[model samples]
Target chain A: MTNVDTILKDMIIIPKGIFFRGSNASPDEQPIKQILLSAFAIDKTPITNKQFRAFVEQGGYDDPTFWQPKGWAYIRENEIKYPNYWYDNHFNQDDHPVTGVSWWEAMAYAKFAGKTLPTEAQWEYACKGTDDRKYPWGNKEPTLAYANFAYDCDPTELVRSSTSVYDHPKYKSFFGCLDMAGNLAEWCLDNASTNYKWDRDGKDPIYITKDEDYHMVRGGCGLHNEDFLRCTARDYYPVSVRDNLIGFRCVVNNVKEEEL
Target chain B: MDILDLPQVEESRRMVCVCNWSIRRTWKGVRLATIIEKAGVSNTNNYFLKQISVGTKEKGVYESTIPLEDALSRNALLVHSVDGAPLPMEQGYPLRLFDFGLYGYKNVKGLSILEVTDIYELGEWERRAGYDKDGIIRPKKYWMVDLKGWGFAEKPGEMTDF
Candidate 1:
């Protein structure tokens, strides 16, 4: 009946706990920290072209109710009519994961749909769970089937297959999320920081939200024959920037069992 | 002017792209500030150049800026050489940038326009995707491959052109 009721399907619930936040293999990832997050509901897959199309068709771009103050200004300045790839007249189908939307666009989509982008902390907790299991499916390495990477095709494509969008048991995270490792880098609601160690604090930890350099993008994509597919490899881009490799999923504060 | 003709410094570091992947490449080139200086721009101090912008031919991923403080460091360069050879074709050849503070995306490739402007712009990668303008790595390690070894390639042998 409402946006919350319809859009919340296939949303996975991440429980409250102290999950691993960063890795020790590199400088930025160094000083592995523990984050305590309350329960939340995250979309099983990154927002799809078909889903986002509904938002645009519903006047999402024109509606001030769906946008924040700065986001509205950004959309106005860029005159962003729709997803960048949409105008290219490519991947017009409904199945492809939407790419080329900036962080503001992603946030607006979330707000329009009554959801929010998960922070990088919540993203890691959902993907890898409490321990260091290595990936969403398990400790195993990724192949073509597990998540989409190392491919030479165009940027936007289906999330492997129609069934894999929210049903593929293998691609699901411990909290039942799909495409956590590859497919597309999902934007998190955190700023990119070299000193992430100091930013770690408990209770719905969202870091570098204001006066920040870059917003955070999690997960990996088919672009770059990279080790970026690892669950811990966080990436970033400026707020105004857009890319073919970028897309995002949405999350919500977990309601009580009776509320659902 | 040819980048090779400018004063060159050997820049070596375990470079990591935005994807949280690492590559150890030794590059030689002129400091980005030096390149700006050779272009006849006066007052190349970091403060004045903080608003400096860079434009690349790559689309969607548009303009970028260097806090001239970072640009002045011999660490950042408009590199033409990597590992005693011309910059590889797979890599951004001819002239590519190195941002000591930002990720490899911040180290923009296929550079086209270099100017001092007030417009706050993002790289084509930064613009198209949500990459950090500051080039700091995010805390999550959900990387595609592991350059530091997760039974993954521990060296440049793991790098690819995709």
Candidate 2:
């Protein structure tokens, strides 16, 4: 298969279902609610360095059609020709998740790849599944074996860096997605709000605000403590701040006739 | 010089990370100015300070640089304790710099080497990881971990609002 075909084939199909979206973990994730979502195909792992390298080399940054107007303008203004860590040898491994991408860049990539970022509801549903597990891999606390987290005050371990996308198979989510609990937090489609404003039952709920506002990043990364790694945990960054702690995955919705 | 032997002062300050997290805690350490003065480095403005740490090989050794003036500022501290407790190993047990004016990267942890040089040097993160050279705490929305809430810093440089 071609590289694009292989990348497309690696997506995991999450069937349509009803799942609890939030938890009592934090005020932002308060008032646990059930959300219904259509079937969607999500990248099994985050977009890898190799996968995104194609986007960069294929003139992804140069193409305006693949980018939002704001994103296009921002890139042109700052002259952002590539991912922030594109040339950094430490983070640019073939199989490692690409980091240092802002939500706008991630959106551009998803558009370029013929997909879109998963909505916050979709992302959280796929993570917790029907079980409402505290973590993607279930309720057990995070360790180096389960996720690539910076161990809490562990003296012996020194460096904290993102490993290969699938370094820890045990970190898989309920839908058999890898690295959903850690590596690099994945950007979602929705803009971030201080707390959930959706009703208790909603379908494919997404809280989009002004394009320039902060956007949500789900899961956690190597630098975060266990609290941020919980399935219901929520964090966000301004749409333009491209730090190394965030990356993204693409999703293609399998819209059923009933939904249409 | 043993950092513990130096005279110390305790101050509560907000430690901000470039990654959008902040925490306010009491840190006890000797002021950087005191250490620099004791080392007989009187002409502080003529040089830069490089803070090096014993980080892992895979990620490269962690290093950060600051202007000599900022390094010798009253807020710059070589901290060894937090909240009445000695620093944990992960928190840079032996000695670490606490400069609230800059991001967490500039307050280098696991600190092992302190080099004073005439020329400005880019830090490890700045050289290899695409971080800003100065890493000043910029105005942004930050998750206040200790407060269990969110805060917006309206001003850039030297976050003193606890």
Candidate 3:
């Protein structure tokens, strides 16, 4: 069995609460609405190259049981053996957040860890908390000190690449989730929708589709500007396209009400 | 060759990124066919055109390879201006190729070299990441940055639903 300690050690238990979703910043983020989310434990930081190495070494990619049917077919058809940037020296450091992973690969990794990708509501709540904050940290705009983003970092000290997941000590969210603002945008469980125009009120609202369409990605990446780094900012990518700027964190829903 | 010295076409076109976002803007530049003809290059072998870009430190050198027929199409343009202004440095400054029928990756930014070859060379993103070498614009729901919302491209190829 894969050691549970590595995946569960730093999990932060977020209390059940209501947090506002969406923002007026962009049309996609319009008509801010309150979303209720159940208590869930989230990884303290994004899954790192070191953490994912275990999954790869354990033949996570070769196992079909861990992946959805469509995802499995895609991996087989594309002959995907590992993350897209698996061998790239620039992004292959042990502690850097693992990127170049498609949404399906992320889903497989989550399954391998016995966890699930966070629903968009859970992810937003984890970052925004009870208060409606513009960013993960607070209302203030992002500087390099807050998050790793484009046009912000000094080129001398850092190359234009993802830093170690442990680098941003100050960019923690309300629920103590680190690297939630920028590093690599995290994948959420929901399928891509233009806006929150549907009925997502009340508790544990998650959007899924019968079709294997594009999936949502949240937080921002090292390559995007501050506008995309906001907590409410959203984007999507095809399930099979492995991008270097996208990574993910996993979460486990609390089973016991008393545990909350 | 100075691209600005060649014949230019001022037209508006849509550029769809493989990431599923797209934008439409008025572009001003010389056609790839015009530039090729002015350079006195022969494509009798139906060779592919390899485009290289002066890419940034973050992205390295961006590259794209297009079939000779597509390169000579009326829509294949080496864009220098967008939306009535000089192309922003981030948008590839002086010159960038906009192959309207293909995904944005095919439109190499900050173009530096144009080589003719018979072999099908994979572009930078296709080589580094696992992008499709063809880079065609597929019918999909694109997050239209210009429209500030999602827009569906009902048909494939160049998105002309203005």
Q: What is the total number of backbone clashes in candidate 1?
A: 37
Q: Order the candidates by DockQ, highest first — what do you get? A: 1, 3, 2
User: Each prediction's interface RMSD?
Assistant: 6.5, 5.7, 6.1
How well is each residue in A138-202 modelled by candidate 2, as lDDT tens digits? 99987778887754322234444568987888668888888887778999998876567655458
Candidate 1 lDDT by residue in tens digits, B1-162: 776677788866545555445666788878877767676777655442332223446433335675665456535677788899988755666667766545666655656666665444554554555455555533333233323443232222113222
lDDT of candidate 1 over A1-260, digit per residue (tens): 66656666768766677876777655555567777888778888888888999899999999988888888888897688798777543434566678778888898999888888888888888888875767777777766767667542223454332222543455667777887776578888988765365664656677765723468788776663335666677666677656666788998886556434
Ranking by TM-score, best first?
A: 3, 1, 2
In model 2, the runs with Cα more than 4 Å from the true position are A1-8, A153-159, A199-201, A256-260, B1-11, B18-23, B26-162
Worst 10 residues of 2 chain B by lDDT: B124-133
Better of 2 and 3 by TM-score: 3
DockQ of 2: 0.09
Q: Per-residue lDDT tens digits of candidate 3, residues A178-198?
A: 898877899999997777776
Among these predicted structures, which one has the highest TM-score?
3
Better of 1 and 2 by DockQ: 1
DockQ of each: 0.26, 0.09, 0.22
| For candidate 2, the TM-score of chain A alone relative to the native chain A | 0.92
| Lowest lDDT block of 10, candidate 3 chain A | A151-160
The predicted structure with the larger lDDT, 1 or 3, is: 3
